[model samples]
Target: MADLQVEVMGKDEGVMDDYIGKFTLSVTPGTKEVEIEGTVFKIVMGTFWIKIESTPSQDKHRLQFPYLFDGPIHYSRHYSPAVGLLTNFNDAWLYSTFIKGVPLFFRNNFQLWNRKGPASFAVRPGIQAGHRLLYARAAGNAFGIIEDTKGVVELLHTGAQDDVSGGGGPNAQRRVKPAVYTYIISAEDASFRFSETGAAFFVDFASKHALHSNCAEVVRYSGEFHPRPEGGWQNFGDFTPDDPVKWEFMIDNNSGTYAPDKMLLPEVKELFEFNFPGLVVRALDREDERLVESREACRAYALKWRGVRTDELQLHVREGEVTLCRRVSESGQQEMKRAKDNFT
Candidate 1:
């Protein structure tokens, strides 16, 4: 079992606020599958409060909806967990995927801003309204820049790459670079006024020109600012849906699942258990005598009892417990369950 702790902090009206969260992943001793669970807590008015939590079910796991903190004009966050992804539903939604064999986790602090009134940070990208205004260029080896009518914003690579290659033609072999850029802004001013303005300016510029269409990939608008006396570049945060244009920008450029080869074995097992309780019970009972046996022997017994080839079956054993899985025809599974139930 691997454990990870996540924390987020911010300041409001000179008062400090914080959130603490943790998640754990437990892997079977000899298998690549894992079970995940976690919870999150926040400090409200100087007291700790439970925000979100997850509990394992008899046959599956359920993740609780995340809560947003409302306190002293500070940052707030939302969370959601799906089949293989966990997301921080903030203005700049951060998410991570859970691949079968990979252990993943993330933690970060963001200075939140409210986009409700005139004091809020807002921008109008020119693309939606048909205007050309953004520009980009690779600068030496340190970073890049995205500039507009307002000013120049430095950008860094987030190590995330996307290929926008279209139909093959004369330029089929051309090397295409990723379009995403990390906008760097100063956070010393204690507000997102400067960063927001710069982001809006860049979006407007990128919307009008074909040469900078790649700029559309710049869905994430992050910054660097001084949080303490010893100043260093830290990611303040990214643009969220508060800005209608930025929201549409992400929807148009950054929405989709990247897991093309994700496995469906677990999902199939769930379906089988849901519809074939009797057959599943019989199968479990068949292996009850071998419950305390070794993995190799138990697996062999399960295979022989099921009379299914290895490719069609998945036998998982952990701590003297055995689970039988196989790709049975939907009708066959239903019939088996029905037959078992009627047998006595």
Candidate 2:
């Protein structure tokens, strides 16, 4: 196995004007994973840019283009232990290595998608992950979706929070910002077949929380897209889906809670009906007596129907605990209830 280690430093230096950090990146050719461990020495009141290039020429291009890249890369961060919850300082920084020799492609443009006010919707083309694999996130919650020739499958959902505020102090309400998220797709993914030529790579966005019509607001959205090498990297200009996919959430006022639903706006529904004649969207009602009895069971049922593996789906009915279950049939709502009861 081939291995390479390198040290990375932040761009700026002044104690109060820049970020001082060190990142050690280790690349393992066998597993195709890069492990990054580092420390964030100091961060000033400015955004920091970290770039890793294969050659000096590439580094120069990165400096000039900033957003363009040509290589396999993975980025992840861990809190700094030295900071220990200190304000304005992350404790640590950790990143993963590249996997499968797949070079991650990034879109140079930094665009923001916002839907001005409450009860509104916006549709945009999502990134194409070659094989339907898509990485998406909203307000810090990250998840992946796999949509093959068969249908769409929701991968594991992570960073689920009961309260949108994330349990901050009293000022949390004031600090609340509209959810802004992004998605990435691999241009080489087979899923690009579903996208229009030249506009094959894309990402979609939607606001999770409804804002008052009277309130003035805007949520900034920006991120990079990883394109596969098979097609090289095609710059199709800005992303605009021919048939915009709408993601709607099912919110039951009676329960005062919300969950993703199969509901689609009339126009979006019509577009899907025409484009994907075989597409099926299951409607799950929060008011259903059986579902209300076991929210986890409801989630399990919904996820199973959507092709999520039983082991991949986890439910936490209480604090600091987890429950797992096998697949249940549509007629086995009772079985799900029993599983929930027994587990809890």
Candidate 3:
């Protein structure tokens, strides 16, 4: 069992007082399943979901461990000073390496953890550098952060135009200016990166087809469709192939956020009308009633992976402890109980 205190801080060294809280939880050795909303068991699996909020500001921030846990999970609830809403969120995995209990190198890019080798770094629980040490740690690819003797956050390697902040000091937020963004995901492992705006090219793991998308209308570009020479996003809707096979707009929703039926599809239909003037484009989400077969096919394909389904939890602060609550099922609602409590 361990006792922990939590505090929320801003990039400018200002503490969010309202978000400060204390909680205690038991961590059994070799424990397997942890019943957060029910009875506790052994073997805890899946990602850790953490949400922090302030009462006065009313700003709520959520941090969810990545499905394929590699590095730090960063989520920004505040807007950047440069851009209002654009470039507001950044989701990327960073990696660092250690050998023989000494820091070797640190790289902020998409790289898997190097397991099974003579130089494999030690995997241990708790953080040592920060003011408030985090005792709870999980198995993952790389170390989160390491400070040099000089108390400086050192970056041995970084991608092109990679900006890292909050080095050997308190938590700092990275700054990114607003510009055209290019999202490239390999079809093989789904490893993705949001490249710098107007980046000429990128090279990643080998794949038959590379899924590419710019901050443009929802459509897949085929057969030598590149960004326009002029800055900003080029509307691919303006281009028409001489030998057209089929004209269709593809809505990709790997984020799992519901945007197809509400935002992307409607905007795509409008763009199609504006570009072709007379052509009418009807777009639908995969789960739409009209596309029952497609939805079933998608489900079948997903089932092939045998991915575990995680529950959606609601965050609540009750009596100074950070507890997770989940709504009761309809059958249990007759007793007037709304949720089940589980402390983290």
Q: On a 0 to 100 scale, what is the lDDT of residue 223 in model 2?
A: 20
Per-model TM-score, in order, reads 0.15, 0.20, 0.18
lDDT per residue as tens, model 1, 1-344 = 33333343342211112323333333223323222222323222232223333333332221221221111111111111210021111112111111110110101222222233122112232232111111111121111111220011101111212221121123222221112222211122121111111121222132211112221322111221111101101111222111121110110111111111113223322322332232121111112332212223323433454253453222122243211111112323565676699996
Count: clashes, candidate 1: 5
By TM-score, is 1 or 3 better?
3
Model 2 collision count: 21
Against the hidden true structure, what lDDT does model 2 obtain? 0.23
Q: For candidate 2, write residues 208-324 as lDDT tens digits.
A: 111101111221111211111111112111132212323221112121111122232232233223323444322234455532433343334435433444433221122332211
Clashes of each: 5, 21, 7
Tens digit of per-residue lDDT, candidate 3, span 195-253: 22222111111110121322112222111111111121122222332122122222222
Off by over 4 Å in 1: 1-104, 114-172, 177-180, 183-344
Best by TM-score: 2
Give the TM-score comparing model 2 with the true structure, all chains together.
0.20
For model 2, the stretches where C-alpha displacement exceeds 4 angstroms are 1-67, 77-110, 113-115, 118-344
